[model samples]
Target: MAPSSNLLNTQIDDIVKTVLEDATGDVYMVNPSRDAIEDFVSVATADDDDLPTVHMLADERTLKDVMDDFIVASNAADLIDAGRLELRTIEEAPENSLLVTDDAVVAIVHAADRVGGLVADDEEFVSATVETYAGRWDDAEPFSLRTPPITRVRNTLSEEISPEAEDDFTTILGSLETARGDGDGLDEVTISLLFAARNEALLYDISKWGEDVGIASKATFSRTKTKLEDMGLIDTEKVPIDVGRPRLRLKIGDERLADADNGQLATVAQSMLN
Candidate 1:
């Protein structure tokens, strides 16, 4: 959201993409500056708790520089193609250049865990690491210091989530909406409808809930409604609009279950504007 005169319009889909691309950070803010957006994306993805391996890769050169140049190859791709990076023989590795094999380079790079300093002479380290991996014992299972990496948080959510939960949630939301359209149907009609809404609206109620789930009684609906009202996830009002009248009417919230019906997205949006 920006000043009407800004003329820079971005879609919610684009904002969501930014959130996914840079997960777990600020999704929206007052100003959508480029630097701010990038920083938000970076920080959202960055783990503050995973502190820098202070002593892990600390060496003559900072790990950032080594990882940046050697590991990530951040140099200009065109310049690299031009052989701008010349291989000057370091005192460490003479006969065996560090650039011997990609696998060898990886082995040497990983050996930092076994080393003392944060950074080491790249030339010598690469050659030694290569030589270490080539020995016959590399095939030995126990000799391998490297274990499978700790699964990153990204991996867990990456698994294909069974759409069952999604569908069930959708169904619950749909039921709430259908009930809203079915306003004032039966005297206690709102009771069953609101119950369905509670069963699926908030994640807690619906997390373990399954589709075609059991129906809720008016009493159960009361409990769930209180919870929903407390969270402000939904609004329920029992009021007598006309003066001196004692009739109870139920009005739904802005976030009704009908919001998820994709076919009516445009229709809903149009209604909202009106």
Candidate 2:
């Protein structure tokens, strides 16, 4: 018999509600960002003393932006950290966002946009999805190593050195931006700037000085900086630039970049940013 489309839609809706609304059991997800996943967990386990253990397998490319979002928002960080959420990164991302209970009684696979997908209890489908997840799990790496170094308390700035330096750096940035079409333009620009830099730390501070040198905006530069930091392609340290306050220095990933040749480093940069 042909099933009623209306009935099927209702059932699917119910399944999604159950998976997101219920405040019991573990939750697992695959997403490029924390967009809806965070809310899913928060709503699922609200008011419970023992919250569900949440596990996320996300794309490595989005790891920096994700971490930056968490760092910028204290509430999000608190919720995830308090829930003891375990995070890992995979180079390839899933086509949909997944939410599975520990008991495997309910599994919801939403779209990458977090808008829709199947929410089912079918044992075979659930089992198959779990198996695919296991494979991804093997390829994933811990999120801790990819987290940004800066904290909320640390007052960081990207103050451009001087008017003379800005003019020279602006010209350099324009030339490098010509390579933008091949990969992540901002990211490639950031990497190229750091790579071609003679100084150990490039003072092209994103927050404070990016606009002066043709960077689109503070947010754009900050995001690129975070991604570089997360990929272990860059590092941040507070240098005592004056008597009053030390400035945050963004430099190349010395441990990796030190021994690497320009060609080799550029290849890696392209791989990461592209």
Using TM-score as the measure, the top candidate is 2
Report the lDDT of model 1 for residue 244. 67
- 231: Cα error in model 2, Å: 33
User: lDDT tens string, model 2, 189-236?
Assistant: 464345423234444454444444332466666676677778877877
- Tell me how many residue pairs clash in candidate 2: 1
Compute each candidate's TM-score over C-alphas: 0.19, 0.40
lDDT of 1 by residue, 1-274 (tens): 1111211233332332322333221111211222222332233334334211100111112222222221112121212233221111111222211112221121111132221101122556645654553442233222111111112111221232234433433333333322222221111123323333433333223322211132234455556556545644346434444676443222334464345353343234234333
Kindly provide the TM-score of model 1 when superposed on the true structure, using C-alpha atoms: 0.19
Off by over 4 Å in 1: 1-123, 127-164, 167-228, 235-257, 260-274
Model 1 worst lDDT run, 10 consecutive residues: 51-60
User: Candidate 2, 222: how far from true, in Å?
Assistant: 18
Clashes of each: 5, 1
